[model samples]
Target: MEDISIISMLLTAVFVLGCLYLVIIPFFKDETFLDHTRKSHTNGATKEALLTTLNEIEFEYKMEKLSESDYRQLKKQYESQVAKLMRDEETSTEKAIDRDLLAEVEREIEASIQQKSKKGGGK
Candidate 1:
């Protein structure tokens, strides 16, 4: 009876440990796989979604479903988000334009140098 009880207690401990390992292992593993599968929405898609949400909020407020203060607060938050998105889009556009201009300038400089070299070599 003593030996059986000891064996049973050891088995219970092992089972508990196994359960804990199953629960705790995820916390220790790399979470990049989750990120890899979860792609973020593009700026256009996100802007459209926000606009739709804003329209819905306006309709709800008109229907008297939301309090005036709540409507104002929500409107402010969504408007800020939209503004930030617009700013990000504009910044990205400006950076692209800058890069194109720089590339054009570099090409022009290279062409001028090559032309001078050819003229000097011929002389």
Candidate 2:
């Protein structure tokens, strides 16, 4: 009876530990996951808003609601902002790709070194 109780308690503890691990591991694995998601979402929303405003400005200008100078200035400003956001997004994407490629290359180099040492040692 005592042995049975101890085994049951051990199983219970293991189950609790497993549950805690599943719940807690993701937070540690990528602490910036939420931040990255929010930043991308905000950038997308801002870009969309700017595009919409640009369209509205064009429509207003066509309807003669804005002076020619004002319309040109607004169009230029919004176009510059949109261009900047696109450039920033592209740079970040390139950086992430570069990091991943670098990590893979490092892993391959390490693996090659290990294989060479193993073969040399066997001889």
Candidate 3:
């Protein structure tokens, strides 16, 4: 009896842990689910890196280490890339805001319906 009870307890614990792994783990592990903050951090890092490289190129040119043509070419490329990143970041932010607004609207609609149903039922 003691051995059976121990085995049953162990099996229950394993089942619970398996259930948590299947259900709860995905919420924590899903990188794209609610990751606006991470996106902004990545954008900041990319912007900073581009600016740093551009400055380095300028410094090199000032030191006469880079030819004028090469300096201008690199500067133009980095600036364009930076512009694209900024545009993409803005778009992503807008999308996130839209999603939040939609969710809020849905909740309000649901609440209004529930309230109407309750009032109707009470009458």
TM-score of each: 0.61, 0.67, 0.54
Clashes of 1: 0
Evaluate all candidate structures by whole-model CA lDDT and list the values in order.
Answer: 0.92, 0.97, 0.94
Against the true structure, candidate 3 has what lDDT? 0.94
Clashing pairs in 1: none
Q: On residues 44-79, what C-alpha lDDT tens digit does candidate 2 reach at each position?
A: 999999999999999999999999999999999999
Task: Report the C-alpha displacement of residue 68, candidate 1, in angstroms.
Answer: 1.8
Please give, for residues 1-123, the per-residue lDDT of candidate 3 as tens digits: 999999999999999999989998776686774586787788899999999999999999999999999999999999999999989989988999999999999999999999999999998
The candidate with the higher TM-score, 2 or 3, is: 2
Ranking by lDDT: 2, 3, 1
For residue 15, model 2's alpha carbon misses the true position, in angstroms, by 29
Which of the predicted structures, 2 or 3, would earn the higher lDDT when compared with the native? 2
Candidate 2 wrong stretches, greater than 4 Å: 1-35
For residue 34, give model 1's deviation from the true position in Å.
14
